[model samples]
Target: MNMFLINFSMLWSFSFFFIFIYIITIFSIIIYIIPSLKNTINYTKFKKNSNFDYLTGFDLYFLLLTPLILFLILNFSWSSYTISAWFGNIIFSSFQYKIFFFIFFFYSLILTAYCSSFYFHSKEIYDYTITIFNFFFWILFLFSSNTLFTVTFFIEILSTLIFLMLATSTFSTTYFYNNLNLNLHNYFNPTTPFFFIQMLMYFFWISLISSLNLFFFLILFYLKFLTFDWFIFEFIFYFLTSTFTLKDIFFSLFIWFNLLFSIFLKCGLVPFYFWKPIFFKGIPLHALFFYICFFYFFIFLFFIYFLLIYMNEIFFFFLIINLSLLIIGIFILLFIICEAFYLKAFLAISSIINTLFVFLALNSTNFTDFIFF
Candidate 1:
């Protein structure tokens, strides 16, 4: 009789737990959809209120609530959970969660600061929705385990969303300028569809190349170690480095080069930076801000995480490559400072310099030194 009662209680508790999750899921979906529906229904009203435009009630609510949600998730021990499988896992340490929460809170502030700049047009509404969703996915990307495939998947999604957001913003700006009959050709050149096409093509090719390199690296890594988990990869790497055969050295170098090249391409480091200036030239200032502050920040964080995982095995190679890159970055920074007349060019150069400094920081032997630098 006692055993039966215990089993019944366990089942009841499980049912309650699932019910709570279901309720939260439904509530979240309702919260997300209602705002969008409200925006749509009030679109015509918003159009007439253009002169007094500001963030909508929903936007303000989202801005205020997101940080609270993140705080609860980060601080509450009960909110800590991990989903692991043979494929990959999504997890973050308490420290990482705290860092992410603070970063996201600051990002929310930045978004709020720029909220007034976004016009209340139909396309703008779509763009705003995309931006919010993209940020949510970015949070997902940050917490994702260092599984190469999973990381690549997130990268592809993010890149696509960025492209969409930029394109939509450009279109919306062009429409706005046309309606106002502005003579600001220098700000957003609507006449240069060809330039936009070229930029799009270049971005596509570069993204494809980066993805392919990462996929090839993933294949090589899986074949060598027969595992996708980064923790397991670290153990295998340590074991191989202990023996350190010629074949192993060559293989490791190839894998390292592939990974570094892909990350550098994504981060727009010195060698792979040609497309960035052109890309930035076409994007609006707000989009550029988002790209620089949020996108690049997370990519750099990912790179740092990657380095922390494999720093022991690849310290010599990393030191040599990073030093060389740093020297090149300094020269590029100087050249840009001398010749960059445009704001976009200056921003591009600044981003490159920031990336180089991050690489330099990674060379430090101590954690405090790394963080301080």
Candidate 2:
């Protein structure tokens, strides 16, 4: 009787989380679809006089498809949340939630691949048509959760590999076309700093995220292959990123204040000097186009990242604070780069250095215990 009661209580809590996520998805879908609700995206003004031709067929296809893609994905996402949240029910526990996560992972993976392919080769209609197929895939996958149409894991893996191969092929073709073979005449010159700095930015950005994903999957694999510790670390990290409150804010400020200082005020200062002139000279259209490919890549990765954050079951305050400070530092760097003013560059760098030191001190000591989920 006591065990039964405990199980029931957990089911109730799970149901609450499910409803909350469902509400979020519904709201997000509505906001994404309703143009009046969206904040105006000023891409036209930002790119005016740029060499790119005005709105191509590819652009029209992209605009028309994005909302539908987002909607179907979110819709299936909510359904999966429902089953996982309610899976404490005895009859559903064995395969429902396991299949749920697998399907969700693949769904996101397919969307990501399609988006990447589009980013690279916008001229292909057959590639774009795959986006429409995702809508039916969502429905079939969702219905399979409760009823018929369940696919074998081997088949699922095969399908995923196909999508990945397509994405790789398209991405390589695009990259090959776009990269110019320009030899550096003066590797030791001041101009070289620009190339090195950009490389550093890309490295750090990729490294931080790749590490996070690697750690996450490690936990998953270990649990499945070894003993089940219930992946407590995964839960802790997820909770920290997704849940927010005044308490989280306070904890973040107290823990990461110094690192924040150094990154924004110190580390980025010299870089700002390099970037200001670069920005005014303007990003090359071809370079911008290459970056657009990268931009889509990052967005796809971020979607996976935050999706993990939302689903993970643990709580950690320090991680969230550090991430927030990182965001602040990025904004400061962007501001300095946009300003193109040397004085502002100096001030921004100085301030960020001080901030970084403070964050360093806070991180060195143990103050995150006060953090609450």
Which candidate's TM-score is highest? 1
Q: List the residue pairs that clash in candidate 1.
A: none
lDDT of each: 0.61, 0.37
lDDT digits (tens) for residues 328-347 of candidate 2: 65675667544334332343
Per-candidate clash tally? 0, 21
Which is the leading candidate under lDDT? 1
Q: The CA-based lDDT of model 2 is what?
A: 0.37
Q: Which parts of model 2 are misplaced by more than 4 Å? A: 1-55, 58-231, 234-373
Q: What is the TM-score of each candidate against the true structure?
A: 0.73, 0.27
Candidate 2: residue 299 Cα off by (Å): 5.2
For model 1, how does the per-residue alpha-carbon lDDT over 1-373 read when each residue is reduced to its tens digit? 3556546535644564355446545545664565457566664545454533333534655644664576466446545354332223444556555666667676666666555555444535555544654565455545555566767777777777777776666565533443232222344444544435656777778888888898898899888878666666556556666875888878876886787789778768756776776666555566677777777777677667666765653544445566576667666566556425556656776677676666556666643443467
Model 2 weakest lDDT span, ten residues long: 146-155
Q: How close is candidate 1 to the true structure, as a TM-score?
A: 0.73
